[model samples]
Structures are given as C-alpha cells and as structure tokens.
Target chain A: MEQRKATIRTACVEALPLAIAIAAYGLSYGVLATQVDFNALTAVLMSVLVFSGSAQLVAVAMLAGGAGLTSVLLTVVLLNLRNLLYGAALADGLGPAKKWTSLLAFGITDEPFVLASSRFQKVGPDPLYFAVVAGIFYIAWIFSSLTGALIGDHLDPQKFGLDLAFPVTFAALLVPGLKGKPVIGTALAAVLMALCLEWFKPGNELTIIITGLLAPLVGLFMHRRSDHG
Target chain B: MVNQWILIGVLAVATYVSRVLGLTVMAGRELNPAVRLYFNYVPTAIIVALIVKQIFIPSGGHLVLSLPVLAACLAGALAILLFKKFLPSVVAGVVVGLLVRYFL
Candidate 1:
C-alpha cells in the first residue's frame, strides 16, 4: 500500500508539468471549438471523449474552414494513425496490466506515451505509474477545456481575436516538433502541396486529405537516404 | 446537435480502436522501418497542411493570403521558437495578429 502511494505521488509530481501544458492547449482547443459553433457542452464533451489534442484541434479547424463531415472524419483518421505506433511501442510496458491495459489504452496519446515510455525504459513496466500520469493529464485536459469553452461562450470571437487562435495554436503546436531534416522536409512538402491544391481551387476540400497522404512520403524518402549515407 | 453527437461518437470509436489495436493486435510485432517512418511523419505533414489551409484563406473562387493569419502564424512560430512554450506563444501570435488587423 505504501509502495503504491509512493508511486502515485511520484507520478503526480512528474506529470504535473505536462498536465499544465495539456491544460493550456485544451483551453485553446475549447475556445477554437466554440469559434466553429461548438457550444460549451459539446466542446467539453469532445475533450472528454476524443481526448486527443491534434485530432480535436484539427477537426475544429477543418470544420471552421468549411470542411464537410467526411473530410473532417478522414483528417481525424489520418491524425490518429500515429497512435498505432505509440500503442505498439507501449504494449510491452503496459502488458503487465492485464485487462486494465484496455482502459489504460485510452490515454495513449503523445504526452502520455512520451512519459510512460521513458518510465518503462528506466524501471520496466509500471502500469500504476502510467495510470497516475494519464489520470492527471486527463483531469487537466477535461477541466481546462470546460473552462475555456465557458469563457469563449461569452466573448465575441472576432472582437477578441479568438478567430486567430486556431492558426496560432496550430503554429505553436507545430513549431516545437520541427526537428530533423526528414520531418522538416515533410512539413515543407505538405505546405507546397496544400498551396497548390488550394490555388487550383480555393477552399478545395481535397487539399488536406491529399496533402496528408502524399507529403509524408517525402519524409520517408529523406529518412531512408539519411540511413544509407 | 445530432451531427455533433454523431461526429463525437465516431471519433471516439475510431480513436479508441486505433489505441487498442496497437496494444493488442500489433503488440510485440516489429513494424517495418519504412512504415514506421511514414507513420512518424504523418503528424508533421497533417499539421503543416492544416496550418497552410489557415494561412491561405479562400475568397471569391480564388485564394488570397490573409496577412493577419500569416502574421499570427509567424509570430506564434517565433514565440514558440524563442520561449519554447505553448500558451504564451499562442497569445503573442493572437495579439500581434489583432494589432495588424486593427492597424491595417
């Protein structure tokens, strides 16, 4: 019992910083969702249910851009594809949790994956620790989303410049991950492809899905080239 | 409202299935290196595409660069690069974007 308590405490301390970051993004997400017509209830509920920062933000942004339901769903699926890798990487560490692994899988997004994978590497499989960290982040994400939604509900999106929040928030999220040549190549390819598609037909629905499908191949090619050199 | 609910339901199921499949079906399996690299780069691609879509807005059957959006994204990018923080960077971007909107 004491050991379990210690694990929980350690997890809380470690997860706190990331949890705060998640909250900040969640707040932004909540506000953005509202700009796209999501009320407080639906916005918070999306956070409660989807629990994915990239997927949710992308969905709202796409919707605001006048994307249809199919397009939004397709984009989300593309975004969620990485969860497969994260899950595969984390499976062994979470294997010891038995049936509980299914429940724990709900928290398999980026931040949790990073923290849990590092913890697993250092001390072996620790589902309890994973649970603690995920739980803290989950609470932070949900509550901050609610708070942001409520706050956004009252304000005029344009007057307060909340309309600018979508691009800015995405830029903030995208900038930190811009490391290494291959990743940078992928982003540049995506930008060019998206620009071409949009230029061909303004507000074209195919731009996002097509760019998402093709641009990553550039990254793969670069990665293989670097590997052989 | 119903559409939103349906969207949420579909997203929840889709997201959970991806998570569970990795832990169960794909567990202990070695993904091909090429496939892994592709998967790894997908987010960067998708995020960049999303940002591009925002930066270039559609108007009257043609695309026009929205300076405010572009400025906001640039400011946001600069802030994140300098401070390495999320919220503040977003705030800085929005503030700059708003200033540009007001002045120009």
Candidate 2:
C-alpha cells in the first residue's frame, strides 16, 4: 500500500510538467475546434473521447478547410499509425495490469508513452505509474480544451509562447536520455530524416511515421557494430 | 448534427482500436533481443522528430525555421544540462522563447 502511494506520488510529480505542455496544445485545439463550427460542448466532448493532440488538431483544421469525412478519417488514420509503435513498445510494461491494460490502452499516446517507457526502462514494468501519468494528462487535456473553447479566439497560444511548450518539454525529456553512440546516432539520424522529409514537402504527413520506422535502424546498426568492435 | 456525432463515434472507435491492438498483440509475446533493443530506441527517434517538426514550420509549402522555437529548444536543452531538472528547464525555455517572440 505504501509502495503504491509512493509510486502514485512520483508519477504525479513527473507527469505534471508534461501535463502543462499537453494543456497548452489542448487550449489551441479548443480554439481551433470552435472556429470550425464546433460548440464548446462538442469540442470538449472530442477531447474527452479522442484525447489525441495531433489528430484532434489536424481533424479540426481539415474540417475548417472543408475536407470531407472520408478524407478526415483517412488522414487521422495515417497520423495515428505511430500509436501502434508506441502501444507495442509499451505493451510489456503495461502487461502486468492484466485486464486493466485494455482500459489503460486508451491513454497510449506520445507524451504518456515517453514518460512511461522511460520509467519502465529504469525500474521495469509499473502500470500504476503509467495510469497515474495518463490520468493527469487526460484531466489536463479536457479542462484546457473547455477553457479554450469558452474563451474562443481570445486566447492566442503563440502570443504567450504556449506553442513553445511542446518542443521545449520534449527537449527537456529527451536531452537526459541521450547517452552513448547508438542513442545519439539514432537522434541525429531522426533529425536528418525528418528535415529531409519536411524539406521535400513541407508538413508532409509521412514525416513522423517514416522517421519513426526507419531511424531506429541506425541505432540498431550502431549497437551491433559496437558490440562486435 | 447527427453527422458530427457519427463522425466522432467513428473516430473514437478507430483511435481506440489502434491503441488497443498493439498492446494486445505484443504483450504476451517474447520479442527478440534485437527487436527489443530497436523498440527501446524508437521513442528517442520519435520525440526528436516531433521537436524538429515544431521547430520548422511549413510556410507556403516550404519549411521556414522558427527562431523562437529553436531558441526555446536550445534554452530548454541547456537548462536541463545545467540544472539537471525538468520543470525549471521548461519554464526557462518558455520564458526565453517568449522574450524572443516579443523583442526580436
């Protein structure tokens, strides 16, 4: 019991910083959703149900651009392909949760996956920690969406540099884990691949999924080389 | 109205299925060591890609580097390196990025 409390406490502390970043995106999503003719209730409902920043933002932007339902669905499916990678990576860590893994799978996204995977690497599987982090992010996402919807276009996320929070938070999370050649090589490879993909056609939909699938091979190759050498 | 509801419901189901399928399919299986190592490096690659995407915004179908975001990322990276902390580094980065946005 005491251990569980400690785990929850640690999870909350770790999750809070990322939650704020997630909220920043959520706020922007809310404002955008409203602009696309979604009422505050429906906008907030999407957050409650979907809870994906990229998908929600892109879906609203597409709808605002007068995209059809089929196009929107197809794009969202493409955007969410990375979730498969995240979920597969996280499955072992969350396996201990048994039946609850199904429930917890709802929280499998970028931010939670980063934090949860790092925690699992350090101390092995801890589903309680994953649950706590996901729960905090979920609450943060919904509340911020509601606030953004209520305030409408009055809140410009970029004006306050809320847009910076996402990358900055990601950098903060990433910098510490960059150790040794394989990992650093992987990061550098990802950067180059992403830049190339984006350069070829700016804002290309395939950037994330393609980079994620291929960049890790650089790390794997380096890992093998180092082992043999 | 009904169309919106149906769209939301379809999306909700599609997203949930994507999330659950990976976990259920991979959870019980024992992955090869090389495969596990590859999975371990996946997050770093993905996170770095995410950061890069944000730093370079698309404009007129071309990539335009955002100085404020780059500065913010650099500040955040340096702060974490110096302080060995998370929240303060993020705060520092946001403040630095905001100043850049307003002043320069």
Which one wins on lDDT? 1
| Tens digits of per-residue lDDT for model 2, B12-100 | 88888889977877555666778767766776777777788889888999899999989999999999999987667877998999998
Q: Write the per-residue lDDT of candidate 2 for residues A1-229, one digit (tens) a residue.
A: 9999999999999999889888877776776677667789889989899988867876775565355677667656755666777888898899899999999999999899999999999999999999999999999999999987887646566665656766776788789989999999999999999999999988866676677778989999999999999
Instruction: Give me the candidate number with maximum TM-score.
Output: 1
True A-B contacts kept by model 2: 0.69
Q: Clashes in candidate 2: how many?
A: 0
Question: Each predicted complex: what DockQ?
Answer: 0.79, 0.44
Candidate 2 backbone collisions, by pair: none
Task: List where candidate 1 sits over 4 angstroms from the true fold.
Answer: none
Per-chain TM-score of chain A in candidate 2 equals 0.70
Candidate lDDT values, in order = 0.91, 0.82
What local lDDT does model 2 show for residue A153?
49
